[model samples]
Target: MTTVIFIHGTGVRGREYEETFKTIEKKIYAERPDVKIERCLWGDKLGTSLLASGASIPRYDETLALDEEEEEDKEILRWKQLYCDPLYELRLLLLKPGEERSDNPFAESPLDELRSRVDNFTPSDKLQAKLAEAGITEVFGEAREAVIRSNAYNEAWDNVSAESLGEYSNVISRAIAAQAMLICYQQEKYAPVLTNAKLRDQLVELLSLDLAEAELGLGDWALEQIARLALPIGTNYVVGKRGAVTNKISPMPCDILLYQARGGKIRDFIRETIAEAEPPVVLLAHSLGGIACVDLLVEQSLPKVAHLVTVGSQVPFLYEINALCSLEFGQPLPEHFPEWLNIYDLRDFLSYKGSQIFPKVRDELVNSKQPFPRSHSAYWEQDKTWEYIMEILPR
Candidate 1:
């Protein structure tokens, strides 16, 4: 009879968590009848929150950050459409007669020009984070080269750059996206991203932002005619959602930040919870919960905690990058860190592999047949995820 304690991920709370917990319990019992199901429901009490109302939202007094965020989202949304249909603006431009300037590739090719610009390019932290999630380590090295040299981008540039920088921005953004998608598509072992709208959108949005930011910095005419096609519709949508947008999803970041900055409380709660559980314990954690477990086990040894299973977890990636709270880069996990089983869905951006870091860990791939945001949470309901658990689970 083993004790399995569940430590949930970020932003999950109350009734929603209870439902998920019950479902998980039922699933576990259906497989292993003897094990006990316990949970460390820390989000409601120990988690981060804006108890001061919107006071902690950092300049929320003027709603400045929210407004800026709102604008970025709209811009990203606009870029998403451009990536989805790389030739969208070009097609629009062609619809109306534009002088095909004779100052074409022979004089100075777009690829040649783009290569020079992107040579000194560095992906923004946000874009780098997204590309990293896609398993693209360096955004500029091979991937960028491929995009610049590719026939797809060249043809689009030849046709569009003559029109305006606004339209040409589409070509550049789409090229980066094409290359990024190609990488993601290749990295994907289970299924193509084409059918996965959420995943595709994510890759597109990030790649678009990467190039869009670059262009903005270089002062490209990308902003020219940005409002030409759908000005009223996009404006209306942003104005309508600006008020309630941040309120709904802001606290989750507080939870994560507090944990990283001063997470002793969260770790203490887990330690206490472990002490209450029976002799042999398996800490089954998801998302942020997994990060906490890694920190907890690293700080002190819990022999009773036999195994640490992380689903849709970032334990390894954080450790590798030295972003993990307790452990630093190149530091080995404590000898008593337990036999780790990391279950990751390729489509889940939140999940990462630990085998490369810990060496002793087992990295299991479980495809939930879901995409992006959904893939992160889908592990709870995935059959393969459970199978991976049951393999070494104390029966």
Candidate 2:
């Protein structure tokens, strides 16, 4: 006899989380009725709270922010992305065919100038102070490496003419810097900075200060604003339905921060749930819950916890960035770690691959045919998700 424990992600609670849990249970029962199914619902008990009752959310009820504040906040979230992936934007650069090789073999390479400038460039004092205050540990060197190795950087290098090399200095350095102070504001530490709209821009502006001052403005920021002029209805949420949108997304980042800062309670909740369930166990977790389960399994061996299934999860990405609570970068998974199956959809940017990093693990693909944000939550609705789980359930 086997048991499958359902662990839900952040920002999910009460009725909706319960209904999805039921859906999963119903699917499992249809396939393997004898197998036990239980849930690990930790949001209500341990989720982050808005003690100020969302006093922090600016213009909470307003149809619009009545200012550039909303736009600036969106920009801040862009950099918070750099904290997770330094090359997040660099990778989006449109690749142009590199300059046709100069007929002269000895023409000095434009890339040489970039390397020299990168080596000589000094990080500003303000940037250093800000980095320290921002809880940005161990990023610049990695960011530099990531930028240098990026396809966009290489493409830019190849595309530059010796005459244009000077123009490209700030572009390349800023690329190395990525979004200039581009740490995504997803962290609780950045909460105060985000509240003050100027700070995020100051942070981004300070990022550019340390780079080339001649300022050719060589960088291409892919904000990629889709002009849906015809979709007047799309603006309704911002015009009059701010609360509906605000309330739904507000908890996501805060919950991630809460788990990172103090996730012991959440993990302990999982242990408590496990203690009540029969062995052997299948830890079926989604999103942040999968991350929690991975952390738990890596920290210690629970023999009864036999298999792990993570859907639309960031476990691999977190580990890669050394942000995971239990494992350090390059550290091997614990000898007692259970078999893992990571399920993902191509459209879900939040999801990542595990098989490449851990050869023994399996990765399952499901197409929700939905765009991101939506794709993230669509995993539970797919039949393939359950079919894959049934194949591995210990009979």
Candidate 3:
């Protein structure tokens, strides 16, 4: 099946993709009724995972000789694993009360309460040992030693401010909840346990027995409740950030996952709609979605995607960007790119800076420069960009 996956760029949410996807899908469907159509929404759950992963992308390279690099990598890896494989940490965090197994929501509250007790708390010798094993000595060491640690956990209860720890903590919590939902969706074996009441009852009882042996305070019931609480929190987060990024060019790692999941869903729909169809795909992508398609293309071959139309694309050589804060825009494109097209507004500062690397794929460059009234947001609002896409899409 020929599929045109519409990946939204940067801080734009999946709904924007839906509006754009439907518009394009209807045209393709009408043109060729026998063809299939699919839209992949990798944006939903995968957004947070991608953001967490990006957040975990170790702002510094571990191979660097600098001590700070090693420390930063350690923290990045820790945060990455916590999002990628959360159950293990959740297991460690579960707080046990003596005998009774309370509801899942409060199961880990006990451990959190204890962790809050220390005054500028130093890591326990045991935690330090674990950190050593993980090659993360100063993971939270500096953070623990901060003046903020001295404030009672409840101190934030009375204060309502934008920079409050309460706000950051809630963000972390929501990010985690999104991850838990992804885990549930990804693992098929866990699905039945979540869906069937009879199985859930049996599993909860089984987990309870394990808890008893470990002397952990949490029961199966509590863990289940936590998962339930996390899903909604994560969903609301994606819905909230529809199309907005203040200073940054792209959504963080977790947000990317959410975007990709949405993209994947749309891809599936396109595939179902157009069976045994092979038509050139024209992707009108902006910002991070442009980079994501490049990454996705590495694994998923698009035989029919004749033109990858990028607007305000930031597909730079990662090494180049790291070495120089500003990469001299290069027209040399990589061999890996499929048939390509690019549109950039000279007014947009980001477009001016991004590598014109698209031409490197085939040593071919098709530069379509249009004057946009607004700086960054003009990619969609301008009528000329759509005309350019319709002109460039392979017939």
Candidate 4:
């Protein structure tokens, strides 16, 4: 009998992915009735303390009082507070007067002329003026105040460029350029701007530049927030929770996975699971779970699992972050690493190809065209995902 062990990714309890694993189990059993399917249940182990500590589900009355929509909006605002606002504030730094000119092509054109016209071009003044022109001054004023009050906003301003906000002034120029393009999109008088393919391309190029710049300034915190937000939203959307904003869940488990991986707890758990499993084990791990598995296989000496399957994983990126246990700069894959297959979807922001990074492993790119959270979670439901796994299993 083959032992099929399933390990789930971050931001999830073991049971959350039960349906996906069960589906794969059913398919495997149809072909090989003797297969014994087991779940690592690592997430459950991590959450045990919380559950034991009286982290109960909200009472019925409390749940009833909870406006999911309001809560979701608050969560979204919290996400923007953590992720977008830092970039926004940094972008504002660009609007400050007497800053150096941006080399960005868009910054040289009509957009530069617009920035020159804003009185003083200070952050608060420029933002207020722009919001007034957009007819959202009141709403944006409140939002801006909220962001200014946030710890993330203050920390970013302090740590990123406390001396000269001038260093990031170009970001504001790009924002003005984007606003110009958006204005063109809205006004019939600027219809030609939209129809001109070259203009459209230039606009896209400018926007891309803006994002790249923002990413550089936003640093690691923004990346983590993006990853955390993507998974739950993707999974919830895939499972028909599209309109349910209250479904925005925490990525706390992701933190748990990282903590465990760094502390060697995950390695210990994997070792225990492998020691107890029957021979010819097929290890199937998703997302962060895949990263954890790879860490164990590389850093420790353990009995060989016949095959390793990683779905919608961020192993490559995780390694880049120095989160992988045995990863070394320019080091080759450890000799004992199992035969590996990585499956990822283009739409899943958290997922990326690992074969090039760990050259021995093979990779397959499957399109799960669903948006953020759905794209990340869609792999398990895809028949192609299982086909790849089945191919690696011992016959």
Give Cα-based local distance difference scores for all models: 0.66, 0.67, 0.40, 0.55
For residue 117, give model 3's deviation from the true position in Å. 66
Q: Write the per-residue lDDT of candidate 2 for residues 1-395, one digit (tens) a residue.
A: 89999999988876657767766787788878899988788998788767887676664333432222233233344443443454544444344335555534675454564555565655678877765543343455655665666676665555555554444554454455442234433222222232222333444455554553444544333333211110122354564655555665767888999999999989999988998999999999989999999988888789999899999989888888888889898998988999999999886778999987776679999976544455687676566787899888999
Query: RMSD, each candidate, Å?
Result: 15.1, 19.3, 20.1, 17.4
After superposition, candidate 1 runs with Cα above 4 Å error: 56-240
Local distance difference test, candidate 1: 0.66
lDDT of 3 by residue, 132-169 (tens): 43223432333233323323333422322222223223
TM-scores, each model vs. reference:
0.56, 0.56, 0.35, 0.49
Clash pairs (backbone) in predicted model 2: 79-182, 79-183, 79-184, 80-183, 80-184, 81-184
For candidate 2, the 10 contiguous residues with the lowest summed lDDT are: 224-233
Worst 10 residues of 3 by lDDT: 60-69
* lDDT of predicted model 3: 0.40
Once all C-alphas are superposed, what RMSD does model 3 give against the true structure?
20.1
Per-residue lDDT for 40 in model 2?
85
Report the lDDT of model 3 for residue 20: 49
lDDT of 1 by residue, 109-152 (tens): 55445545554566778766655544455433665676556555
Worst lDDT run of 10 residues, candidate 1, spans 60-69
Among these predicted structures, which one has the highest lDDT?
2
